[model samples]
Target chain A: MNAAPSASKEEKNAMSSMETPDAELVARVREGDRNAFRKLVERHRERIYRVALGMLRNPDDAMDAVQEVFIRVHGRLTDFKGESAFGTWLVRVTVNYCIDRQRRQKTWDARFVVDNEWEGVSEESPEHQLVNAQIGEALQRALAELGEEHRTAIMLREVNGLAYEEIAEVMGCPKGTVMSRLHHARKKLQVALRPFLEEAGERDLADRAGEGVRRRE
Target chain B: MNDQDQEKLSLFLDGALAPEDAAEVARLVATDPEWKAAHRALKLSGEMMRAPVEQAARSANFDGLWAGIEGRLPAPERAPSLLERLRAFLTPPVLVGLAAAAAAAAYVATRPAPTPAPASPSPGLAATPRIAPAPESALAAAPADASEPVVIEGIESEGSKTVLVSQPVEPGGTTVIWLLDAPDAAGDGAAAPTTDDDPI
Candidate 1:
């Protein structure tokens, strides 16, 4: 497992959220210690924020989802059951909530251009930040463009860094299904980010926009 | 790279592959340009996803997250249940009814056994006027002003009729007597009609 590259801030966060036993904090909260809930919120808010940001793709909406997710977990404290990692449970809750929120919001902002979702860097900005921001915007658009389940699959695996089994458990799908989703999700991402990858020096992205998968066979 | 090759690559990247399989994918990627570029593209996808996380962290307003949730959290105090609310509103009327019932009970319990008719003798019933000169209950609730003595001039009761009486205590002021019914029992001891009667 350690051979997996130390990839992103998200993986680092998943590691930290587990370093301390969430069961202990969860127990404290259930024992009527309200401030313990503050500790709980602090521990998982970032991951929750990231998932919401990934699913909702709006800063303000993601922030709102963070608070709403915590409040929801608070009300259902008794229902946590310690069956899954509190973090995974939170992601499940967040994904379901964002899907429902999007339905209620009815705003499928599916524009995958590399500029619309860029917030931290602009095309006119310095080349380094601009490149990362474009990649980021492309990723956001591409993620938003997938079906809800596919988007959730990638978010859980790539964004939240959950294991295949953990993703299966959180998504209530079989491991094979999880594997298939992740495979397709990444393939579509590879297709979508082909331009970025080529610019980053992965010359000759197989023309797999449609029949790309059959080529791999 | 076929689906099996790509799936093995994914397993290798995520460290989900067995050692032999990971070493094999590593060997293949080392020798194959196609697998190498596919691996690079997948890794780039990961980095692209991280861009948003980093960017969001740069602009996220999460400092007040706990406070926002806390501010809206319904205090642990539960909303009163239906029975609780009913009891809360039912208190005054119930107490008033209990007070009137208690007063009648106490009056009944203290009635002379011989059934003396103090007012007028009717065939089966007579008005018994109980004049409490210094009512203990009235005095207990009276103000500190000792100048005017609180009096229960007369308490009259017939079979089911509640009788009210008025007596002129001061030269021009007449004290209006009140009675409690089964309904308005709360007004029995409170807000009684008062006049500037000079005598007790």
Candidate 2:
């Protein structure tokens, strides 16, 4: 019995030595650990930005939302209640903020521009970059045309990689509804991107043909 | 493929299917040309959609993010992201307690005395009033209610698993709707027993 107690205590110590969890960090922030709040921000900023981008579509608007979302997250720290995963709450806040911003401003800017900051990050040839940019713009256009619920479902699935159960919780919908939305969203995107996809497919074939001739040479 | 099969294909690709369903999907993909084509199309579109978001994430400069937010943090917790800056030059073990504090002091002390931290323009940042638990956040933009209205209370109180209820919220054609999950066999939400499952 005494050994069992020691073993469990050791296990706890080992666990404590591992990386701190979001919940523990939440507690620390509540207790006024300023650095813990920063740790939380560092860990979750990218995902939150992705969520914002998925909702708002404009890079400038999304970038702005990162600070807003964190502000909301910190201000409402008590209401967090630990009822759901902190990530889920962050997503909820982001989505809600985007919704309010859209409603208040009435600016449905349909452009998802590949801004200047992304100019030369990759070593791909200029041709590849141009082609990818076109595809990216095309994808954004198609995503822009989807219904609000459908777009959110796709973003949560592809961007956050959320499961059906978790997504349902975040969206306040049923598991069946989440799956149905994802299916319909995929179908819509497939239709919208068909022309570009076919063109890309033909290019792949042509490239393979050129490679075959080069090999024969 | 029917909608059901299409949905299954999406789930299968996501690896969200159960073993039996996955095996079934795999078998169909192996034998059926239609399923194969559908799978390929869905996969391609998904990849195309994902590329820009990944590109955006890669190119984003997150370094000044904490600086932008720390200034606007609510109440007494507002302090510069001192540790965030320290982590740029120090390893994790060096971040503990008084040693970390001393190292941070030293790190700042070594910098030329009058040179302040660079004020990188964090775009879209402002010192605005904060709404805790964000009072307006709950008003998410949803699809406007369908034009034609049908009777819903009958289906809800009968066998449906979820229900939409509306109550008039004052005057100007604005109605509030609640989407409530059906309580157990107790039937009515008001009558369901509450449990003491508080995490606090």
Candidate 3:
């Protein structure tokens, strides 16, 4: 009986030590540990920034979403009763903030030029960097033209790689809604990028055949 | 493919259709040229988006983004956070002691220190307030108007000062009153209840 009590106590301690940094930091943060809070922020910032980029498409808006996520997380740390995993909560907050920003932007002019357009290479180097930039810009433009719900759903699924259930949770909707949105988003993207895709494919075939002939020679 | 067939094919290309439905769509797309072309386009778009943008946008000034977000956030109130509230709640004795020391220091500052009270006959036995029992007469004397209802009644004797006392009760209504006989005019009350407060 004595050994059993000691064993259980040691087991509890071991489990606690293995707890995630977010929960550990939360406990310490409640005790006013600033260092612990900084650690938590550092762990999540990059992933949060990536999620923001997927949703907003604009680097500036995405970066804003990232910073806001950390601040809001810090401010509301105490209210985190640990009901959900910290990453799950952070993803939800990041997605919601970007969507809210998108909603607000819509109220203004539709012609707001979101420069998802990145810098392109000159005609002098039209092969590697240029093609990549052209494809990126085309993809960004096509994505921007999608409706808000479709865009976010596609971004979460394809870009962020969140599960359908996780996407549903983040979008504050049902799994069926997530599936429908993703389906529609995929359809819209196919229509928007069809011309570019066909061109890319023709180019790919020509390049492959050229490479094959050169090898034979 | 008709619109409905086209829509189902699109979803299938992205792997968003249910398992059984997806199997059906896959069979159709494999055998049907038009459906195959449409699926190819959908698959291509998804793949293109999944590809990295190759380089980080040089125009993305993360510092500026941080500043903008900070500007928009309602500046935190200068007041302390909930953590501060909890710290204060936990250290009631420390605060009470500090307050008493401050009051004494202020009085001493105004008057003169009496040569440190001759070094206190015993250096180890520094003064600490104790809950002296209320005289029997005080409890027994029950105000002649006891019939009028005792507004606040409590056990003020033997280690039960107001700081250590529980809430008072009456026939009806509530009145906030402490159980202390009187503040120790000479010293400050330091040792108070640590656990008894949980009762009421």
Candidate 4:
């Protein structure tokens, strides 16, 4: 068997900054360390949840997908050859599980398709919370209208901040395919969200005008 | 505008375009109203799509997720079957060997037996032969040998055949079934090979 590749100097520095490196955690898990597995979950659960939510849409479904993903990860942990970053592998699992679940349901018209709901806004100002909720809802609605492949690409690119190549790997497609999917997805989202953007722009303009009046007074 | 222009604009929006191409797009966006509109829309859409992940921490159910995952985990020290042990040694390439062996075994096991025809056919006609599937109970009760690999074969549908092979690997680890395209099954594109080591 080939030796696991050594972490580069920059990678070592980055992992040193963290409480425990993912590779170390994975190694421990492989050796039957449940605590290490839990730690890995603690570190990556939020991002996994977000990716699940992006693909599955419904909060309950997303949560279920998150659980299924980790379970599959645990079952297949031994097979993880450490060929890629743990986060990349985990994200791939999450995306594939969500896609499978979505296919099973086969619902095209479902609402609440992706991301966090307008439940908890930590903003102190009620106005800010309301605006955020509105924008969030609008964005979710627009995302729901996209095709599965398009939505997956957009989520990987925009939400997870994966590079084109990483997105390609996660989606199991070529870089060019990823770009094309993102382009089409973005175009569709823009068309769907133009009204919301215009409204938000108007609201911003009105808010600025009110501030100007207060300053004048 | 055109497909090429749109793709270029998309690349520009994603910052994937080369510096020269980006500059060209920037000029177009500056000089062309349509390109500017498209750019603004794509930019806004990208921002909204990105917002969810940035704010994901605020909405994630971390405690619940951990609880769910922890509850479903199997015991780490649970003993695995001997077949499971053999599977660990069988890598992706070895999967094809197992598949071929399983197919050959299946053909030998399920091959039809010829019998002498009756002296005279019935007045009406000969009856068509029907193949019955193996009983589930029999399959379940059958004991698998630890020394030799086990092969199970059946038809999944009209045109598709399924063969399952269990082989031993190292030890302690559970059996993992790695499905691969059979050598003779290539170019059919019916079933894609998948292994636990590789992400599907």
Top lDDT prediction, candidate number: 4
- Docking band of candidate 3: incorrect
Q: What TM-score does chain B of candidate 3 reach? A: 0.31
Superposed model 3: Cα runs more than 4 Å off: A1-21, A78-81, A107-138, A206-217, B2-36, B52-200
Report how far off residue A163 is in candidate 1 (Å).
Answer: 1.5
Q: How many clashes in each structure?
A: 2, 0, 0, 9
- Model 2 misplaced stretches (Cα beyond 4 Å): A1-17, A105-110, A113-138, A206-217, B27-34, B77-200
TM-score of 1: 0.62
Q: How far in Å is the alpha carbon of A104 misplaced in model 2?
A: 3.9
Candidate with maximal TM-score: 1
User: How far is B118's C-alpha from truth in model 3 (Å)?
Assistant: 43
Quote the TM-score that chain A achieves in each candidate. Answer: 0.69, 0.76, 0.73, 0.73
The digit string of per-residue lDDT tens for model 4 on B1-200 reads 87688788877866778898889999999988678667776776666555544555365556677778889998779677888888886888899898999999998688643221222222322222223434455344334434343444433333433434333332433332322333343444443333222311
Tens-digit per-residue lDDT, A46-130, candidate 3: 6677777766655556676788887787778777778777877889888878778878877312121223232333344457445
Give me the runs in candidate 1 sitting further than 4 Å from their true place. Answer: A1-21, A107-142, A195-217, B78-104, B114-200
Provide the TM-score for each candidate, comma-separated: 0.62, 0.58, 0.53, 0.56
Ranking by DockQ: 1, 4, 2, 3
Candidate 2 per-residue lDDT, tens place, B71-151, comes to 987567354588876766576666566687898899867943221111221222222111122122233323344332211
Each model's lDDT comes to 0.66, 0.66, 0.59, 0.67
**Model 3 chain A weakest 10-residue run by lDDT:** A108-117
DockQ of 2: 0.15
What fraction of native interface contacts is shared by candidate 4? 0.48
